[model samples]
Target: MPSIARVPSVPAPGDAAELRARARGALLGLAVGDALGAPAENLKPSEIRARWGRITGYVTDRPSGTDDTEYAIFSGLLLARHGSALTPAHAEAAWHAWIADRAEGQFRGAGFSERGTLENLRRGLAAPISAQHRHAWSDGLAMRAAPFGVFAAGRPAEAARLVAIDGSVSHDGEGIYGGQAVAAGVAAAMAGAPPITVVASALAVVPDDSWTARSLRRAVAVAHRGERAVRSAVVIGGYPWTDLAPEAVALAFGAYAAADGDFKEAVLTAVNMGRDADTTAAVAGALAGATQGESAIPEEWAAPIGPARGSCLPSMAGHHVLDVADLLTPEVEEGVALVPGTDLEPATDLVRETDPLRHNAWPPPDPTVFVLAPDQDEVRP
Candidate 1:
């Protein structure tokens, strides 16, 4: 068997202050971008231009994240509790308890893939089976994948592995690949990897020929020509859904590469591109935030971000991203003995024990799942 290439370990943070800043930057950056881009979701570039004239900053007076920020909180809390021991069953149960079994009004702000997962879970389906619905390829998983990267820090492969576990319940195939790419990229960024190496880390996780990988490569290839060219290269014409995993992932990485990991530029570039605006910008924000640290984000942009409004997942209300950031990167103290397994449970036996490569294998494991035809005029809330 050919040996897998070894990825260099990202050095642990030199001190607690740097760790706190990076973690806070990543989650807070995601929320800021999500709020900034909500108004532009599903709109065309021309329409965005006509309405906001390049969208240099927040467009609404009371800018708050939509489904994107809320879902990240949902996933972040789970990762904080489970750490690397997270399993599909744990994720499925979290879905049921926090979302699926909740009141219908609480589930209002989810995206297509989440809606599909909730419906399947409500109907008593289990994961892998539960993920077998239409719209499984949406960017839902990718949008919330940053916490895995933050937790894994310098371990890109571990980040990819954990995110695949989290994604298995709600997405498959390209959708999973998209989340892996983002997780790997953010993991690399958290470790202080350069912009080019960060992008390389992203490409290393998913198969080269997969739609997510191909779109990402194309977008990065033309990133030097600026955001418009990158958008033109990756976006699917005549496709109604703005949340396709491949397209959204590509656009986000493109924005990251274009800005060379500059928080403001990467986020604004994604926001202006218009398709799946919230997700793309949120992803860009995560990547750039991890690379630059929270202090690097503009004060004005970070100010309005309070605890999530929980428009989507009501249980997540009042749970601030900053609080989650602190949880993921706790302050290191002197003379405090670390206790093992005090907070987290031991790894569950229910975890799938397959080769990690099998998760991203070509032709996908199950091809019988139906692909819904794109409806150009359909708008999802």
Candidate 2:
């Protein structure tokens, strides 16, 4: 556990260096907040305060992140590899190749939604069918959404679209909405949007009447009153599980709103609120970190974050968040579109020459041409 250090203010944005810093801050903050909030995950606020007085820093002697951080790294690597063309097929294949089919390591701690998705995949189910589980509305997707925001910097709609594609393999309904809100919020923050605009960006992506939207509105509405008030406004006290997407996303945004996007204050506010603490804090951390840039995080907190241990996903063992940040922060060329599985899209003439079907044919081709194709199934009649 590290002691709290003086937090720095956010610097001006608009350069590659600043983007990199914000990317680093977003991921490092997620890990830090995950580790900080792990011990308080499902406890009530009273229980958390009773156990650790106010919890200003890491509470355990050997603090480490949980499923939230590792899963975020997993999604980050997938996004880095595929970029804009990322599809549900790509995400599903990665889940099987990197996680579901593995047989070596212990399938340690993970959220119910992840376990459910893995079970469905092992049973030969595919997404979005694979996502039809009992806990489909869990915050599992939200926990791993920040990387999409990092990859689609300044493009909130693109971030929401990409994260939903990733979430289809594991979640649905409010779960998908929750992921969208977090990803959009981070994307706006990456572009140096103010806290109010960031929250608005999040709300704009989801349906206006959705559970996630409603809870988010309620939480932010009361955020000025503090964590207790925010918690009261959004949390469903009778619910047993604390990982509801609506509740968790609301709490996280509430914390961010309450602190006005200050990295340390936002993360701590989420942590102290108690229910689904790890995930709420992780989302809050990502938002605040993006808004404030990496320099805003306390050195004591950042120094302890390292390569993920892969307790939750063995394939992510040696990759660090900083490594992901580097992969996502490359310089963009002015008018060249980047392609997946390669560096850049080929010139128009080159594409036409290489791919005959890519260009428009002058006159309309025979309508029956497809009916005479050689590969058609033999017609016994």
Candidate 3:
């Protein structure tokens, strides 16, 4: 669908090795959170308690990620190919080539925003126009925003800008802002920023008066009191839809704040909150994981994440989150392409130029920083 064009890698600022670890942590943590929260999505906190006494770990015997993880892998692949030159046209084409044009069976578990965008695309509507739907304000974009952060590591503003381009085809207004917040937070975390700084980075990206910003402020303000306080401060009870971008993003940031960037605590808190649990937990997991690195995630939690099942986006099936992480922050040497199908002929130049985000910089500053190792395992742990 969307080809991996010749993206000249420039050397980026910061520790390349550490950036690689954080990138791995962000995507892997997202998969873990998605799998852990899948069984608890949409249920109220009380209902969740009634079903499974505060969900501390994977509920199912064969735990696996949902649409949240699949969609992230989809976005990460696109970012790897296009780098900073990604546009709405590229995103739309990828959507059509990898998703909308395919003869999928049932389109299981996709959110309304995705369905609406696909419908519009089939009707010949372009982006910004394809994004015209009632569910355009959902958390769909936020669910896949982490890759932008990984790609534009250390640059919160750049991460926000890139995610907005990706979201333009399926989200608008608050939806776009929510994605930007998550992207900015993860970007800051990737650079080893602390939790407070991560939150500040998120706030710095969106308009101060926007609903997403306000909700984030309220949630973080009450985060010290714990998840329940954070929930009460931000969540609007009886709102019917749990996928609201503002509410979900707030809950995620609140969980991250409450946990003080602890990978286990942040993810578990988000999972227990119940509203859009998968997406919220995924976002929290990405933020915290980036802050703490891949080693921070529990081995038990990391073990369950395998190649995506691709229940939502079939083209993404068989692709592992680790592989996507490697692709985003690649450290390959010589002519071998990080990804299989792509042709990266200039092996030495590719090795010399590892940072993909360099081209996306405002004035083209310095250079920077994928592929999975042959561990032969389900997860890294």
Candidate number achieving the greatest lDDT relative to the actual structure: 3
lDDT of 2 by residue, 257-312 (tens): 99999999999999999989999999999999999989999998888788888888
Each model's TM-score, in the order given?
0.86, 0.84, 0.85
Candidate 1 positional error at 112, Å = 1.0
Q: Tell me how candidate 2 scores on lDDT.
A: 0.81
The lDDT ranking, best first, is: 3, 2, 1
Please identify which of the two predictions, 1 or 2, would achieve the higher lDDT against the true structure. 2
Alpha-carbon local distance difference test for all models:
0.80, 0.81, 0.82
lDDT (tens digit, per residue) of candidate 3 on 1-381: 111112112223335567788999999999998898889999888999999898989889999988999899888877876676678888988888778888653454399998888899899999999999999999999999999888777777778888999999999999999999999899888878889989988998898888998999999998999999988888877678889999999999999999999999999999999989999999999999998989999999998788877677777777888878877776645444443233321212322343222234322243322222210100000
Q: Model 2 TM-score?
A: 0.84
Q: How many backbone clashes does candidate 3 have?
A: 15
Q: Residues 108-208, candidate 1: write the lDDT tens digits.
A: 74887988888888899998888888988989999999988887776677778888898888999999999989998888888788888888888888987
